[model samples]
Target: MIRKWAMRAVIAYFLFGTAMYVYLFFIADTAIPQMYKGTSADPATFLNARELMLSEEYSNIRNLLFFLNKPYQWLFYYLILLFGISAAFERWAKKTSKWFSLQTLIYLFWLSLASFIVTFPFAYTSYLFSKTYQISTQVFSSWMRDQLIDFWVGYATMAVVVLVIYMMMRKYKKRWWLAVWVLSIPFSIFMMFIQPVVIDPLYNDFYPLQNKQLETKILSLADEADIPAEHVYEVDMSTKTNALNAYVTGVGSNSRIVLWDTTLERLDDEEVLFIMAHEMGHYVEKHIYKGIAGYILLTFAGLWITAKLMDLWVNKRGKIWKVEGTANISSLPAFLLITSVLLFAASPLTNWVSRYQETRADQYALEMTEDPAAGVRTFQDLTRAGLSQVNPPYLVKIFRYGHPTMLERINMAEEFKQQVSEE
Candidate 1:
């Protein structure tokens, strides 16, 4: 009893201490100045940062929405942890005479549904805020449908993961984490390969970009970058979002360059080319493949850590929480919570790797297009369209910003111009 209490106290201490550090040190006010200190360049004409600055009202609203959304998200997750939802669900699931997989599936379905229900108001409020701010064009009905689609996707994915997890646990008994980590490799790749074709289309319509002139320029860039594609696609995101985005998706035959309609419609041709070039650079450099390799290593480490930590946690609290074992359906939430905490703690390291890849892609865009000014302008356009913070604190950059900040991107473009000039 004493040991159990002691372990719980330690965990509680670690969890809260880490949370406070991450929030205050990583997520608190941290945006550096737009132009680097000691740099005497007018980055607007030189680097394109000045035009993207939002009005005070828009900046505050965007920042406010972001700040509000984070806590709302954490509240739901915390409620699940504070309440004995996982153990209770497990006990209830055991009462059912269904197959173990069926029981797990049912429990997961309810969990997903309940999570969506609890979070919907907060989610809708976010959408309302976006709409009010002219950032989201999605109608309530379309948004609800997207939410429903999201639930299905999440439910299906969870069910599959849970089934595989317990199956491995039952079979291996002890080395299940190793097995699951191995399984995550192919599953992650498969997910990426299918997302563009199978999953993404459910949320938005995609058509080949219709501007023949721009299409030719993009294909020319792709050719120069040696990216093979059927064609670039334009997703009708403007139907639902005033925010702009574009990306390279999938791998191999499934690979595609998908531009949000908002992106195509909002930016000038040079800016659009820069955006496409950046995304295309992902393929030219094969970041996805490299990311998968990195992900495999990360997963292996994370799962090992999780298994060790969860073993200690459950050893002390299993009886109290009423979770029978790691194999129990009720333990899923605990597993999720543990992983969530671990992932949060690991955010800075992971975010840094992502930012590095993004920066590389940015560099590639500058080189491939030979258009540093346009590349800088592209980010400026994105900042206005997406309401992205121009210069988030370095700590926020370490934890939350997967891509380089607008300021950093502009700085990169400035540096690129100097490099080209020396040539």
Candidate 2:
């Protein structure tokens, strides 16, 4: 009976994945219109930029990525396939007390293996570009080694936390929904604090921002913007890649501005200042707090709905499954399935919020900086440096991009320039 159920589980995973791929392939173009339909400074130019990206000349590189897209997608599907297989096997083993602990280990091994395989390629591609362009110092091999180490550490840490949550849910089987809420909220906080202090350093070297003059300027800018900044630090971003970036992280006293070393190397003083202004804008506008608050609220709503949905699902599965909770962590396959579906549905909502915050930051940066031209130059250089598509389909831009496209940024800056001239 267990063997029969295991086969059914494996086949179901393949079918679900296939269905998802089919749905995306067929409806992706229809699902979202690309450019910001919402009122902005100018819709005509925005539409032009969107149209340009879809043009063959502008999108050649993006089109080429499609060559690898399928293979990458298949790799993901197969990783999930492996995960489902192991999960089914684990469930069978769970039937007997003697095999329970051993099966749990086996389940963890496969879970780690699947996650590693899925994340490795993304990490590799990002690493390769950074190193090749001198954006990062780490070679391909070294990056791979580091990734492998990081993978196990991360996988072990997350798995242990999840296992504890699962145990709680199981213990309170009658109140599994309540258990999920209680565990997920604290778990989210645990994750946030751990990511910066522990996980981040494993990937990149974090040190005090080395350029004293630059640091002072940044702090002053933040003060001017009425954003409190605790520390200004630099990450050894060049070690892994050369892509230039600056971001503000943490909140209140813990909040700091981290400038990528590569950003300093590539940008001139004014350009760096403009970049710093942009990051500080996020703080000044309270975008971080708003985002976190929004996430917490949404998460609670989503979690409640998910718990209820899973409760119905668990009940449907009936006496055949002796799991304690509506959402069993040991039934990792089902957990993955449900989460993937929820994330897929939530993708558009997530993208919209991110784009809104980004645009707000961009506007704030313009308001804070004395040099709009510097912002313009920085955005232009960043676009050229990254080989990013200047024009992209409105649908693609809307769905995939977090930041506004290069063309859009330039257009917006030009508008700002016009406003200054009129004044």
TM-score of each: 0.86, 0.75
Angstrom error at residue 369, model 1 = 1.5
Alpha-carbon RMSD, each predicted model: 4.4, 6.3
User: Which digits, one per residue and each the tens of the lDDT, describe model 1 over residues 35-139?
Assistant: 465352223333344433442235544454444445444445444544567667766676774688878877887778777887777688778777876778888
Question: The CA-based lDDT of model 2 is what?
Answer: 0.63
Off by over 4 Å in 1: 1-83
Count of backbone clashes, every candidate in sequence: 3, 12
Candidate 1 colliding pairs, count: 3
Which stretches of candidate 2 lie above 4 Å from their native place? 1-84, 87-106, 118-137, 309-329
Q: Taking the tens digit of each residue's C-alpha lDDT, what string does model 2 give over 225-329? A: 776665688898676564678887765555667888888998998899888888877776788778777777776677667666667765665235544444354
Lowest-lDDT window of 10 residues in candidate 1?
Answer: 40-49
Q: After superposition, how far is residue 47 of candidate 2 from its true place, in Å?
A: 20
